[model samples]
Target: IALTDIGVGHDTLMAEVVPGIDFIIGGFDGRGIREAYEHPVTHTVMVRTYGGVSDLGRLLIHYDRDAGVITGYDWSRISLLAEQETPDPLIKEYVEKNIRSFLKRGVDNSGFEN
Candidate 1:
């Protein structure tokens, strides 16, 4: 969900692109459970938040606000950055670094640029 306009909006976006395998598609699909929602006949999806930049132009990141930190990230950038020979690794690194710094209460994740 694009929770922009908050105190740390960009931080919310950055955590998404952080390198991790925590977001495999089927990961969110509850397994071994015979829930009708999982049936192929269903077109509707069960999710909370949605909409932001991605391959499909706008992507959704399902987040559970009650517990905290991001649980997954869909690498939808690949579709959008198709012509890029080398994606902006710097931005991702900058995000991770800022996250670390912020965790240490020594720095913030904003003011970064190409």
Candidate 2:
């Protein structure tokens, strides 16, 4: 549910009353956090997305085959900022193409030039 204003408002309460919901995606609070809680009946995982496209949240959920229950999870939030590495050719080309369109329209005035 896109809680683009309050950042998972009432989600904790929802977890208390609601049942059978496995994952909850919430964001727009400009901060990202991954938290897990054990309700009376089940466990719930909640993720808050970061502001804009500056980062990507990768979540890995582990489950046991023998028992029908969620075992655990591993999560990482990766930054999109360059960290001194050669850019991928295909991605660079695509970015250049899109930037060229913006440059042609004079909308890209952030001092970056080809």
Candidate 3:
């Protein structure tokens, strides 16, 4: 259902892994691939998001149990800006409290290593 496809060029491997699966989500180097590419054996609904300060991806899927298929879907990536108003109190608190600690953990005099 979901995959973390590292690097920008490894996108084709996502489909190649699961040939006929209906939905496949991937993140490969933030190229932001989104589409249902037609395949030889089956059609795939592939979705990916822009990485690193791009936006938040929201996906809504509708399924038909009788037909055993996904009837429809809506995919979107919301841009997060510094000027935007805070929508959720919990998230805002977590960010304000933990973001500094997280960044500090990832840094030193040499900057980010991994």
What lDDT does each candidate get?
0.35, 0.65, 0.66
Over 32-69, each residue of candidate 2 has an lDDT whose tens digit, in order, gives 66443345555566766568776777777788989987
Candidate number of the best lDDT: 3
TM-score of each: 0.19, 0.53, 0.54
Could you give the candidate ranking by lDDT, starting with the highest?
A: 3, 2, 1
List the lowest-lDDT window of 10 residues for candidate 3.
Answer: 33-42
Clashing pairs in 1: none
The RMSD (Cα, Å) of candidate 1 is 18.5
How close to the true structure is residue 110 of candidate 3, measured as C-alpha lDDT? Answer: 65
Question: For model 1, what is the alpha-carbon lDDT of residue 43?
Answer: 27
Which candidate's TM-score is highest? 3
Please report how far candidate 1 places residue 11 from its true position, in Å: 40
